[model samples]
Target chain A: MANIHDVAKAAGVSISTVSYALSGKRSIGEETRRRIADAVRELGYRPNAGARMLASTRTNIFAVTAPLHSGTYEPAHMAFVLAVTRAARAYDYDVLLLTEDEATKGLRRVAASRLVDGVIVLDVSKDDERTKLLRELDIPAVVIGIPDDTEELVCVDLDFRAAAEQSVRRLADLGHRRIGLLGHPEQIYARGSNFPHRFRAGFLDAASALGVDAAFAMPGHGPVGVRAALDELFEKQPDMTGLVLNCEEPIQASVLDILADRGVRVPEDLSVISACSSFDTTRFHPPLDVIPLVAAETCVRAVELVVEQIAGAEGPHVELVPPHYSEHGSTAPVPDLRDAR
Target chain B: MANIHDVAKAAGVSISTVSYALSGKRSIGEETRRRIADAVRELGYRPNAGARMLASTRTNIFAVTAPLHSGTYEPAHMAFVLAVTRAARAYDYDVLLLTEDEATKGLRRVAASRLVDGVIVLDVSKDDERTKLLRELDIPAVVIGIPDDTEELVCVDLDFRAAAEQSVRRLADLGHRRIGLLGHPEQIYARGSNFPHRFRAGFLDAASALGVDAAFAMPGHGPVGVRAALDELFEKQPDMTGLVLNCEEPIQASVLDILADRGVRVPEDLSVISACSSFDTTRFHPPLDVIPLVAAETCVRAVELVVEQIAGAEGPHVELVPPHYSEHGSTAPVPDLRDAR
Candidate 1:
């Protein structure tokens, strides 16, 4: 309702003086500051964000583009988004969350319009269309997930391969000769979901190197689907003594049920580990022993990188955060199956 | 990047004509359209979103604000946000997501900066600070959850009281006299969470009218906490026949464990029903009878109302969606406790 000019006139000061007083960028006399404050209160003047952006050439806003599925806002993803937001705020910036479909047109529009200083793209595909567009537009952008080509882009990624290899090695050390891997649905990988494919590759490669028998299956949501998938995996590979689950949502009760039905005990007969996010671990029934969701930290780092790049810092940079595992007593020495058989 | 002026010059047309051609807002001769397309492709011209917004005064964006917990997205809330996005897209608008902390400043920025035409606020509190600010601003706003003062606001809310009453009636029909209500934490209600408080009020009122003995408790997350909460409830009122769960996630596994531990049979010894979102129902093992997460539909309706109001439509409007229950074999006539004892 009140403009900067009105505040300036009411405070008996210049517009620049009023601006400095509000932003606290420059020092003003105590009496002048009091007068400006009184004027602002009297006029109910809220500083216009657009005018501020126009003056300082800084919107103090970061944009994020991701898919808008029901599972997209999972606890882990939310944590990552929040971490980015909190990190951005620390530097006096806000986050603008844009969905994938909207990113194609809407984000392009917002970026070109100068609504935000930089953007962090999530759920990035192997050859992300958004990455190409961002490069084409010369808009400073950071990608959360790794893309196929990283030559000229700022990107942050988790060492999924290392995490998977470590998990398999842990199982191998526990004497598990036969292991089963429960992956996300085929559609996720077939559609080029990066994390699942990377984890799967690392898992199988490590299993082969260790000379251990391994089986894989894609499980869907809910216990029924998980139960069916587990039953199929067990029926096909009845000798499997350990499981590595890469599914997003945990199948806590169903996994327990399948183990019970097969007359198996956790750690003793069948050790279980998953590539779970920290949020998932917190809510997991029998807290999983696996890598914490590094995506959040990656997001924060990506935002910082993007901001630097936007401010004309340097060339493309990449950050790879190593996975940290949470040991929760779900893994142990595999039991002797020959005696039971 | 080639600007619109370059494309316009190459196409031998005014910038307005090129704009219209690109937006498909007006009919142009086939030859003219072809020339514009060729010019755009040849020059790699992309429309600038900022300049376009300033010129056209229609950014075609809607904003959404909601709570995002680390371990829980709350299925119902997710559905609502998605529904609003999908619905907005159908009407040719993109949805922008804002978190709870960002609501005050971020929303104000988006509105005053003309980044979005209108906003749909979810998880509305009794005296929402955001609502108060929105009222002061001259932007169109819609609230998904009911506010304390709804005189001038457009709102879409579920009849929580009626839903609770209906649930009680269903339990009563099954001949349950003593019912246990497992509600969300008091902190949730105390923080002005609308649905839980309304549901509790309805449950208490209906139980009182039905002359049924009822008790309420809020369970913590995970099996251990849930079991302890259930044990406490049972200890306080051992004769409880029907259990109504208000908090969705924690109780899913705990209910099964509690029943198994107490040697109680579902439907026969106890009946369970919950006001849970559809996503929660799908993920839940041994699904409970529930009122579907109608948040998405509410979101859609709220957005529509806000857009209409922003477009200069008259009068305050409200849409109250009724609770629809699903019978998933979780409820039945209460068992004869005396005979079993």
Candidate 2:
């Protein structure tokens, strides 16, 4: 509730003196700093963010741009946002969230106004309009997702291709010869979502090497989408013994329901694993076998990289967190083919 | 990309004329207004938010105060925020999101500086600090959750008590005499979260009226919390044949796992229903029979009510969205008691 003026008045010094003491930019006598600190404690004064930034010549704020939808902030995205925020806070910085539509004007305004020192973008497409703008502005920026043009930009992302291959290898190790993949809705992949395509390529490469039949289907994000995708997959590959789900939330639930309805036992009649974030798998009904991917951790790392770039670090930088899978109740070896039939 | 000056220059008018044209305060010649519009379109000019707010009497922005946790932007909360934003956008407004901790100084700065026209507080506690501050500041505001001190406040919320009662009655109608209630975590309830307490009270009252044996427990959000709570609930009341879940996402998954692990068949061994928002229920696996509560709808309604209040509408107002349940695949009659025994 206490303002800078209150702290200054309590310290019996000018507001400028209090500001300098807090920022530690201009030298103040030890005694004066101590008096200001004591007054701040007494008044419970938290420095004004805008004024502090102005004084320090650093905003200490990172901006993130994502789509603005009714319920788009799922656990994965939320985790990413929070991770960036907490990590920034750890480094004594704050964050400003922006929408994709606002990126053109918003990024320009925030950067020109010095509201943020840097920016980190999420859900980057192959040819992101924001990326083009960022390049033109010459602002230090990082992309959470891979972009088609990463030559001059800093980025942090999962090795989805390797991750998918690893998931398939694990299933193959369990002696599953027939596999089915449940991908996100076609629209997301069609929009050039790098993850899904990378995942598909990896799965196909692994399946071919293992000499097995692999089927792929794109499911909607809802239960209905899940049911339809599964129905089509099952119809196409009725003998498939393993399932790999890449869709988050809605489809995850629907997949569980479809399996339950058909009385197909997990890891017995069918083994299941997914490339979902840890939060997604851990929170579902039957604990899913999932690769432990944390979007938030990735976001945090990206923010750090962007901050470094903003602070004058040279050259394009890329960081990848290799996918690690955690087994829960969903995966197992191929059942007896005859018995399954 | 274009500044006000560009529009003004293109229109052969002063910057003040451009500002007035945009604000529509004083009547301008029809031809001049058309020329200004043409100039704005040609230059792709957009109003600068900060400068516009400072120059004009109104900010045309609304601030939403909520929990700062990563989970705060989950589907339910995200829906509510978006709904309010969409509704506000209809009236040519923008929203400013603030966490509870930021509300005091944040609200004061925005209100005093006229950065926003009003405030809409969500996830409100019985004794909300933000609400108190807003009242003291005499800022036009609406609360999305009910508070103990309801006087002089406009509130839009579901009747959680009634919803809980209805859920219990539905169970009882299906011959579920022994029921268990899974409320949100103890920490959330302890923070004066009114919904969970209201739910508990309502369940208890309804159960008492129906002369049914009922048990209650608080589960944190996530699979671990769900498992722990379920383990505790079952240990305490093994006879409970109906279950109600209140925790969102992470816990929702756990609920399913615990049931599956315990070999408790849903709708057969236990009928489950929860006071969840529509999005939560719709996306949940084995789609839950949900008390169709929507936080965003409530928020939008509350925002409208607040706007009315700011426009000099009459005294205290309370709006309630009635409890409506969706029959997903999760709920059914309790299995015959004899078979259970």
Candidate 3:
């Protein structure tokens, strides 16, 4: 029930000073900001939307443009969205969701109306139309996925290429020479979704550098897709002993199910690693090793970068959060060839 | 580029008339409203946020409170959000997403600050806190699920109970006396999600009325969960000839895979119906007969109802969208008991 006047009186600061401290519009002293924040927490002061907008000329809201594509894994996409919302809440900003169907037009409307302080772009493709608009709109924006051209754009994402190479090295260190990668559905790559392509390229390049036989297939979905993908991988590399899964959660589970049906034991007959997954892999029957695509880490950083941009931060650039690997006994040393024979 | 003055001039009205007509604050004549609409479209006029707020005392935004619980099915949840957003867009309203972590607090803040014209509640549980807050908030709201008490609250959702009863009747008419339902994870039911409980009750009641045997199991997740649930079902009714799937998509696919492993053919060995599912059942191995929980049907209506409330419609009431069934050859006349014996 407390208002700005109460907060100002409690903080022992002028009303305009209190407003400036809360809005981050004109830089007030750090001491003044701390006192204002303390008074706000104590008094539970909530700014009236209209008064806040009029005083600061900034809406404490962010436009989150997340376009769900045909090949989108909902859990992962939802994870990113949830993370961004939570992160923005930490900065006291509400999120306005702009979905795929309204992507560009929504962005234009929000920007022109001064409805949001900045924009956060999710599910960025290699040649996205929104990225071009973001450039022209002259608004503070932080794209969560990297597009082909990063010119004049702030972007953040997991270093998927490095994650792929790391997966290969871990298997190679375990003495596996032939490796196969089960990627997303064919349309995901065909549609030029930024990360899948980056991961695939990194996998191939890492295999070539290590002189290991590598085969890759896009496991579309479900058991049938998993079966066809495995068949193709075996055809490409008959002696494959190591496998990397870089696809949706359902497909990964299907791959495990199909593998079990064929009596191929994980870490015994073939080493398997679930790479760059958003959902937990530990719940799997054999609990595959994982290089997690942590949505919180990337999204938190993206929110910070955009907030900084709104506060007049430096030129635009891309930041890639490094990938970390966790083992769950899904990988092992390749069986001795002589022993197998 | 067209401002209020330009729009007023084009429509041969005063600026205040233009504001009132656009805001729906004071009812304008139907003819004048039509003229204002025409001018708005032809001139491509968009209201500036601050000026519009000052003139109309209305924010053309809705707060969508969608709290994702542990057992929340992401695809269905995402579908509903997307549908609500698209529906709101038809009324030129934007959606501000409020997630689980910020559910009640976010709702209260938006309502208190007059940030949104109305609230759309998603994933409402039996004892939802948001519903209670909504009753006290004095703002326009439309809940997408039925809570325990609909007193003084507007509610919209698929008729889940009817959908369940229809599923039971469909399988019974196929001459299958023994029917089994594979439901969501136990935690989902334990956490008091409203729809599943309603559906389960209706399924049981319908079976009792029809003098047919009914069995239900909560398939937690994955192949192991499916196997365990099937074991439980068969133990309860050894001659189970029809199955109803009321779980997440992954669990449904796992059910088919496990059933195939045991050499059970759909609509022959047993009939299956996907009940109240949001996703397309046609993509299943043997495409299912579905009583779909259509997101758009309910969401579009919910948006309409909330807009009506914002424009001073009737008192709080519950509206249930009727269920519709579709066949995909997943059900047929039950196999003869004599032949099996």
Candidate 4:
């Protein structure tokens, strides 16, 4: 409730002196600064947000436009949001959350008003309208997913293509000639979601390059849909020795359950790898080998780049965070029929 | 990036006239208002957040303090957050998200600086420290979850106790003499989360009143844990003909899967009910009866109450949205065991 004048009077200093001590824009004596600090604590005087923004040209807030559409996997979305929040907090910044309802309008309002110094775009689609708006706004922004257009936009995301390639390579090196890919729901791919398309392409391209037999299936959700997907995958590649799951957690868990139901042994019968998964693979029945989708790695980097841009550091560029793979004995060498005989 | 001065010059009006037109603090001629609006659009002028705040004494923002602790179920948490965001938008307010790391500190900072018009608290624990800090700050705040101490706080939440009691009564009316409850992870109860404890107690009390045998178990996660919980429940009440699931989606799915695997048919053998579940229960194996935890119901009401408080209307109070039950053929009359024999 106390204003600058109250703080000044209590500290026995001018309003300008109090502002300087708090802002650190100008040097003040230690005794005077301590007195100001004591007065501020005693009176619970908080500098007005408007006054601070006018003086410093920074509100120390970032607008995080995370649109949760119909196809969003909540766990992954929540993870990324929390990661960005924590990363922003490390720089003494707070996040203004913008949901799907007012995606672009929210960004525009916050940026135009100088309420936030920069923006962090999340849940980006291939032809995202927000990306175009961000480009036009020319505000300090970092897109967490690769959009169709990259010109004059700073972007950061997991190298999904590389992750897919690595998952195939890991299985290929294990002497698995036949592999099956379980992708996201069909709508996710049809909706022009950027990452799933890239991951699928990478999987097919890597399979082709390695001369490995690969079949792809998109599971809907739950046990029934997952079972049908597995049946379709087996029908296409009956000799499939390895499987790569590139879908949400529930579907992946269902796939594992279905496999267990069918008496299929992991690693021994079918080597499995969880690609670009945000959830913990170790929790799976047989802890899986996973190219984990690390939210913090990309989100932290994105926040840092946006902060750098806010400080007027450099031009826009795309930064791809490389994926890290961990094995939990879910993958193994393909079995030889002759040896078994 | 044009300032008010630029807008006024372009509109051919005094700066004071432009301010009055934008803020609606004073009446201006229609022609002058239209001219200022055109100037604002043409020059891409945005009202300064600081100036607007100082003038109106409002930030037009809500501080949403949602702490995602270890026990948090992501889907439920995300649902509440999104619901609040949409609801706040209805009243022309944006959400400033504050996470677990700076739980109380974030609330204090936002409230003290008057950066947010009000606060929306989520994922409340029994002994939540934020409630105390909120009381001290004396800011207009509405807590979405009920904490242990409700004095001097505006709280909105689902009536978990009533939902639990209603679930038991629904089964009891159908001649289910023995009932079992599958609750959340043990840590959720051990950590003093408000709802689960209330729900559990209500279930026990209701069962006792109806003279129906009752058993309760807390499942960790996955098929194995769910199976163990079911086994524990059955061990306690072997003739359990009705079941109430108050756990996460995966655990509930696991229960259905395990029951199916063991040749236990829904409604015929076990009349299952999902209590306070956020996810669609129809997606389960055999669509179970459910008391849905409608996020929008509580969150929208909470936002409205906070906005009212911000407008200096009424005192702090608690509001509980009554639970709605939906049947999906998961409940039926208990089988006549003697007649069957």
Interface RMSD of each: 3.6, 5.3, 1.9, 1.1
What is model 4's interface RMSD?
A: 1.1
Task: Give per-residue CA lDDT, model 2, range B23-133, as digits (tens).
Answer: 788889888899999999887676754454434545566776676554343666656655676667656555666653564656665565444678888777889777778
Give the Å shift of residue B123 in candidate 4.
0.5
Lowest lDDT sum, 10 consecutive residues, model 3 chain B, at B48-57
Steric clash count of candidate 3:
0
Score each candidate by Cα lDDT.
0.75, 0.74, 0.90, 0.90
Against the true structure, what is every candidate's RMSD? Answer: 5.1, 6.8, 4.5, 2.1
Answer with 2 or 3, whichever has the higher DockQ. 3
lDDT of 2 by residue, A177-257 (tens): 889999878887777766678788889998998887899998865556678889888899988899998876657767877
Off by over 4 Å in 4: A337-341, B23-28, B337-341
Tens-digit lDDT track for model 4 on B1-341?
A: 89999999999999999888987889989899999999999999988887777777888999999888745888889999999999999998999999986767888998888889999999998889899998888889998878889999999999998999999999999988999999998999888788999899999999999988999999966678889999999999888999999988878988998899899999898999999999999978899899999999899999999989988895988888999999999998887652465
- Best of the candidates, lDDT: 4
Answer with 2 or 4, whichever has the higher lDDT. Answer: 4
Docking class for candidate 4: medium
Question: Whole-model lDDT, candidate 3?
Answer: 0.90
Instruction: Go through the candidates in order and give each one's DockQ.
Output: 0.26, 0.13, 0.54, 0.76
Fnat computed for model 2: 0.05
**DockQ order of candidates, best first?**
4, 3, 1, 2
DockQ, prediction 4 = 0.76
User: Which of the two candidates, 3 or 4, achieves a greater DockQ against the reference?
Assistant: 4
Candidate 1 docking quality: incorrect, acceptable, medium or high? acceptable
Better of 1 and 2 by DockQ: 1
In order, the candidates keep a fraction of the true contacts of: 0.18, 0.05, 0.63, 0.76
Q: Which residue pairs show backbone clashes in model 2? A: A80-A296, A283-B253, A284-B253, A285-B257, B80-B296, B222-B250, B222-B251
Q: Lowest-lDDT window of 10 residues in candidate 4 chain B?
A: B332-341
